[model samples]
Every structure is written in structure tokens, then in C-alpha cells.
Target chain A: MFSIASSELIQIFRNRLVLITSLIIPAAVSAFFVRQHETYADLGSLGYIAAIVLFTVAAFGLYATAVTTLASRRQNLFLKRLRSTAEGDAGILAGLLLPVVVLTVVQVTAILTALAVVAGAPANVALLVVAVLATVAMMIGLALATAGLTNSPEHAQVTTLPVTLGVIAMASWVGITGTENLAWLKRLLPGGAATELTMNAWNGGVAVTDSLLLLAPTLGWVVVAVALATRLFRWEPRR
Target chain B: MSTTPVIEVERLNLTYGDFHAVKDLSFEVRPGELYALLGTNGAGKTSTLEVVEGHRRPTSGTVRVFGHSPDDRRAVRPRMGVMLQESGFSPDLTVRESVGLIGRLTRRTDDVDRVLDVVDLTGRAGRKVSQLSGGEKRRLDFATAVYGTPELLFLDEPTTGLDIQSRDAVWATVDRLRENGATIVLTTHYLEEAQQRADRIGLMHQGTLHREGTVSELTHTLPGVIRFALATPVPPLPLHAVVDADGKVVVESFELQKDLHLLLGWAQDHAVELRDLAAGPTRLDDVFRAINS
Candidate 1:
């Protein structure tokens, strides 16, 4: 597992296009959102802006990375080759996804810290941590589920569009009109509860009951995403 | 030191929807022996190999490697190495890194340079996988398969992209590995490799094991061929033989030596000069051709 992970990191760094694009997308999204937040000129809206930015970073950046990497490995028969070794599916999955998750976490932390310095600290640090964990899990599950439908890395752009647009739209909608008066929508759609949780974490108005209420749907998305991924994931390229 | 077979497949079957790729195939690869599996295209050879490699599940029957199911990867994988027709390496990874990574994933320990040197690829270690020529990539595939001196190795068309010298070098390496008590399973278009090296072979055709045995056993199924031109028509030959359109006597004889001796004596008696005389036992190619025929 460690071998696969180390090799993957080296390969990622060597591919100048992937490395540059992965870095530029997150950094640019962070910069854009941070600059845009200045127009509101209010500290409370900082969390809402931060949530949307992180959602974009996680949804489009990390999700696309995982899906593309997994699909490419499958299509090229790299995964089939690895399956012949001592590398188990769990270990392989963790090895491939952990780096992406760690990098996202680091990038998110940096952005949040910068925002805190410019604005003020998050209202609820505990809630913020929960929201971050829930969102990352949800995104990774969604990525794997989406990857199952992707035939190759080349086809990833078209296949990934629906989920990418869906995540962005959900986060954008949540940002525009806070998660209120839409109970079923929050519980059902992919990124719905995740946005609500993050925004609530930022706004600092969550009671224990409210946190549980937000937690249920986020966990539900994670479960559904994982089940779909396992059911649909293909170790070989589509013929 | 035990003599149990390294691989055993019994009544194996694999189907892809309505298409049956392998059918009731059975073969055993004994310990420390080089076994070659050969077939025409769509002969179910690849399907059989993939089942043994645990890359695909059999539709029916069983495959065991090292006394455990090939799908029981934890036990069988550490001791086995496979060189697929395509290495499928990431374009950006360096050769050394790819080798090291596979070795690590298979949980094998080795001196990387030593393994690279085995394939004569130590100098190309720093090159990216994409930068390496096709032949070099093939060598990298071989290097990794033989990296830790795996107990059982599968080489599928292992020398396809190789030049003559590299092919010789690879065969030499395989020779060395066999000497080290490694069990080898080879698949190749080069029948001579099987003829010269395989301790035993399994020939497949159209999803069935067409023939399986020692080289001589397979070739003996067909008759040795003898061809010669006669300077002049002589008395009836002492053996059964037919003349071709060019007036060349062609004899397909199972008892080649005796018939040849009889023919030579008749030629001596008749003072008939035998021209363009050639005699040889059946080759693996002949056996393969017979299957196709």
C-alpha cells in the first residue's frame, strides 16, 4: 500500500499538466472567493464564502482528481496488474485517495487560516471540524461513485460534468439562499446537508439537536455514495 | 524439496456472456519446471492465464496456485510474478521507480541494480517509462517479474518487442532463473522457445486443451518428415513414400531412422543419387499446424 502511494505521488508530481492544473484550480478558486468576499464587507458572510470556496475545491478539484486517477488506472490496466500483487482493494483505495484527501485538507486549512486572519476566526471550531470531515468523506464517496461511470481519463471531462455541475450548483445555491425551509432537499441531494453543516459551523448557531439533524443527511450521502461506488466500480476499461 | 505441482487446473471454464473463452481445460505445472502454454488467437490461452493469475474468475471449475486458490491472493501473490503482454506503466514514472514500486507492492526485497542488471537495464533506470523505447519497456516488465527471484513467474510473450540480442539476453536470464529452482509459465508466439526450454507444454485451440505433454510427446503425435529428390527413377523403394509434383520423394514416417536406413540401402543398390535430402523430426510448429489443420 505504501509502495503504491509513494509511486502515485511521484507520478503525480512528474506529470506537469496534472500537477499544475490541480494546484492552479484550488489556488485560483481560493483567491477568487476571498476577493469576492471583500465586496460583502462583513465578517459573518466569510464562512459562507469559505464554504462555497472549499466546496468548489473539494467538489471539482479533489473529486476530479480521484475519479480521473482511478479511471486512468483501470483503463490502462494498471489496477488489474496491481490486483495480481499483495495489494488489496482497501489498501489500494486508501493509498490512492489518502494523498488527495491530505492535500485537500492542507489546502483547505491554508485558505481558512488566511480568511481568519483577514476576517475573524470561525464561530464554532468543533462544528467546523465536523463539517470538514463530513464534507471530505462525502466528496470522496461521490468521486468513487462517479468514477465507476467514467470509461477513461479522456472521457472524464464529459462524464464528470454532471456531478461537478451538481456539486457547484448545490454549494452555490446554499451560498445564495441559506439552507432554510428546504428539509427534504437538504436530506436528499448530494451536497445539500454538507453545505448546510459547513455554513452552520461558520455561523455558529447549531444546537446539539441541530447538529444531529445536519449529521444524518451528510452521513446518508456518504453511505449512498459508497454503496454505489462498490456496486458500479469497474476494474477494467469499458469495451 | 517437495515435488507437488506449482499450478493445477481442473475442468476450468470461463465465459464472457454468451461467448465461452475457456472450456474444461486441465493442466498441471510441476515444481521448478518451465511450462509453456501456446495457442492460436482466440484459443482461450489468455483467458486461461488470467484465471490462473487471479485477474478473472472462472465461470466453473477450480484453479490452484501453490496449494491455495489463485484468488487467495495474500498467500499466492508474494511468491508469484507475472509479466503481462503490456506493462501498462504510468507514462511519467521513472523505470527505477516502477520497478521498485512493483517489487514493494509484491512485498519482495532485492537489490534494484542487481535485478536491473539481469535485464541489462541498469543504465536505463533513470529514464521515464514513456521515454523508454517499446523494447526497453518490455525489458522493464521482465526485470520486475524476475526482480526478487520469485518462486513462480509468468512471462507472456516476454520477448515480443525485443531485438535479437535482447531476446537472447532474456532467454539467458530465464535460463539462470530455472537453474535457481524457479517454476516458470511461459506463453509465446515463438514456438522454438517452448521447444527448446519448456519441460512440458499445454497447447490450446478454440477454448480447449488441444494437446498437453513433453515436447517429444506432442511432436510424436505427428510423423517425422523426410524429403529428397531422385536423380533417376529407381526400382520400387523398400519403404512407403510418395513423390511430389517436382519428383521429390516425400515420406511422413513415424519410424524415420529405419525407413531412412532402408531407403539409403536401396539407393546404394540402384546407384541412384539422392539429391536435396533432408530429414528431421516433427517440430512444435508442425504439431501446432496439425492442430489447425
Candidate 2:
């Protein structure tokens, strides 16, 4: 499993698209947020903006990446071939997901660092770590769930679009609008937990109540998404 | 004969919704033998192979590889290798990386360089899988399948989309593997490939084993053709089991000598010349078509 994970990491790092999305996108988004912080002169305003940026990366990096990888692996019959080997289902799934998880972690760290340095904002390290972990798990589960509905590699991007768009809209609005009711509703959104967690972290202390609320939805999505993926995931490519 | 069968299937059945992909299939492949699964498209050949490879569990019945159930993949997989119709390497990974990665999965690993050389991909080892031509990619697929030095190998259309030269290269590697005491279960659309490589053939049609035996056994069971062209146009004859066409006559029979003698006497008495006379045995394709139709 470790060897498989290492090889997958190497392959993911070599992919130009994944590299750009993971490294370049977060930096650019952080720059945009820094400019907004200068214009707005409100610390709370930066938290919302950062949450939107983090949400976008979560969707693309974790969810989109997972679905695309699974679909392509199925199309190429990688999943089938893997199953025929000594590796069990868990090993195969973990190996395939390892690279995406690592990329998400790196991207999250880069974005948070940019927010702290460029925006002159202090970060709550412990809360940020929890948010990153939760967001990564949620996105992975969501991607696998989406993979169940995708028939081929071509449909991966399209199948992932609906969830991605929904998360983006809700997470972005909750961050930008700063509405209390929206924050409560964000708890139900796919990336809402990550948004709340990131915001709470930027506030320099863990908001235990808010973090716990986000955890429920985030963990709920994980359970549901993984269950669906395990049930519906086809080993072979569907014609 | 050895008591241990390398692969064994008992009443294996598979279904895709209402479609019966394979039904009541049973066979065994012993070590040092090349077994061919011969079938046309949609004949459940792939499904049968997949069942034995543990990719798909049988809807009914059972499959065992070397005394272990195929469903117990971990116990069986290390001793078996599979070459699927499709290559599964990441487009970004080089040929060397792909082979090396699979090698890590096996309990016994072959030297990547030696395996690549066997497939004649050593020169192109550094090339990305996406950059490889169709045949090169296939060679790479073959290379990876053998990387584990498995005791049993399942080759699903291993030579598909290859040039004649590449096809022969794959054939040679298969021969070497068999010589080294590996059991091979091959599925191919190419009748000639099975005729050349398989020690015995299993003909599958409509999700069932229509026939199973050596090539000679199948041909001997089916009708053989005897065709001859005449030097002069011969009058039509009301001959039994014979086809009289323009200046030629064809007789379908298992007794070649008796049919040839009868044909020669009829031509001579009618003052017709016989030229380009050819008497041959039946071909595998003939038997295949006869059974399938």
C-alpha cells in the first residue's frame, strides 16, 4: 500500500493540470483575497473571502480530482486490474486517493500561509488543521459518491459539476454575506464545515460549538458518500 | 498427469441483468499447458476469463485457482498474472515506471529491464504510455502482466491491435512462459492465433461451452471439403452431398480418399478433364461457424 501510494503521488505530481490547480490556483486566490482585505478594512471580511477560496480548492482538488481519477481508472480498467492483484479493495482505493489527499493538504497549507502573510492576519493553527482534515475527507467521499453515477472518464468533470457548483455558491455566499442564518445553513453545504472551520481558525481560537456543528455535516457527508461509492462503483469501464 | 489443476471452474454462471453472459461453464487448465478460450464477440469469452481472474464473481457456481477460490483474491493473485484487453497505465507514467509499479505489487518481481527487453520495449522504456503507439502500449501491457513471474497467466486478447511483428513477439514470450512451466489461459478472436498457440481449444458460444478439444478433434467432428476444378465444363450430376458449380464440383465428406476416387471416376467417364485438384481437411473456422450457426 505504501509503494502504491508513493507511485500514485509521483504520478500526480507529474500531472501539469493537477500541479497548476493545487499550487497556482491557491496562490492566485490568496492574492485576490489579500487585495480585497486591503480595500475592505474588515478582518471578518477576509475570513469570508478566504473561506470561498478554500471551498473552491476543496471542490476542485478533493472532489473533482477524486471523481476524475476514479472514472479514468475505471475507463482504463485500472480498477479491474488492481482487483485481480494481491491488493485488496481498501489498498486500491487508498492508493488511488493518496495523491489527491496530499495535493489538497499542500494547497490548503499554501493558501492559509498566504492569507496570514499577505493579509496580515493571524491563523489558529489547531482549528485550521482540523478544517483541512475534515475538508479533505469530505471531498474524497463526495468524489467517490459522484464516481458511482459517472459511466466514463469523459463524464467525470460533468458529473462533479453539480456538487461543485452547489458548494461554491453556498460557501461563497456564506463567507461574503456574513449573514448569521447563512452561516447556520452553510453547515448543511458540502464545504460548509470547512468554511466555518476556516473562519473560526482565522478568528484565533477554536469555536467549539461552531466546529462541532460543522463536524456533523462533514462526517455525515463522508459516511453517505463512502457508502454510495462502495455500493455503486464499477470495477470495469462501462461502455 | 499432475493432480493439481492450475485453474478450475465448476458450473460457473454470469449474468448482466437479463443477459446471460456465461452459463454452466466448467474447465481446468493444468500447469505447462496453453488453453485457448475461442469465441466471437458477445460470446461471454471475456466474462468467463474475468470470473477466473476474480474480477467478477459468478452469479452461480464457483471458480478456483490453484485450490484457492478466485474470490480469495489475496491468496491467489500473487501466483497469477492477468493481461486485460485494455492497458491501465497512467498516461503520464513512463513505460519503465508502469512496469516497476506493478512489480512492487507482486511477491516475486522480475527485473524491469529484462521484462521490458522480453517485450522489446527496452529502447522505449523512458517514453510515456500516452506517447506509445497502439502496439507499443500492448507490449507494455504484456510486460507488466509478466512482471510478477506468476505461475498462471490470464491473457485476454493479448495480441489485439498489434502488427504481425509485434504479435509474433508476444507469441514468442507466451511460448517462453509456457516453457518455464506457467499455465496460460488465453482468449482471442484470431482463430489462427489459437490454432498456433493453444495446446487445446475451448469453443464458447452464447454463454456456454459449445465444444472443447484439440483442433484436430473439432475438425474431425465437422464436415471436410474436397474441391476440384475441371479442364472442361462437366455436366451437372445428381450426386449425393456434392455441390456442382460452374466447371467445378465440391463434395463435403469425412472420407477424403473415397470421395476423391468417386469424383475422379465421374470426371473420367464423362470425358471431362480435371485440373487444379485439391483435397484438404477441415479448418477450425469451418467447425467454429458450423457449431455457431
For model 2, how does the per-residue alpha-carbon lDDT over B1-293 read when each residue is reduced to its tens digit?
46688888999889889988998999888778899998877889888987788877799997888899887867888888888787877787888988887776755567999999999999999998889998898888888788867888889889889999998888888887778888899988888888877889999989988899988887899767877666564576425545455656677878877777887788778877666778778888888788746
TM-scores for all predictions: 0.96, 0.89
| DockQ for each model | 0.73, 0.63
Question: Among these predicted structures, which one has the highest TM-score?
Answer: 1
| lDDT (C-alpha) at residue A79 in model 2 | 74
The prediction achieving the highest DockQ against the true structure is 1
A154-214 per-residue lDDT for model 1 (tens digits): 8887877887788778877766676666867854687777777777777676774686587
Interface RMSD of 1: 1.1
Choose the strongest candidate by lDDT.
1
Model 1 pairs whose backbones collide:
none
Q: Could you give candidate 1's per-residue lDDT for residues B41-156 as a string of tens digits? A: 98999889999999889999989999999988789988998998877787778888888888788887888888888888889999888888989989998988887889999999
lDDT of 2 by residue, A8-87 (tens): 77877788876675556655765676667755436346666667667777877777777877887787776776676788
- Clash totals for all candidate models: 0, 0
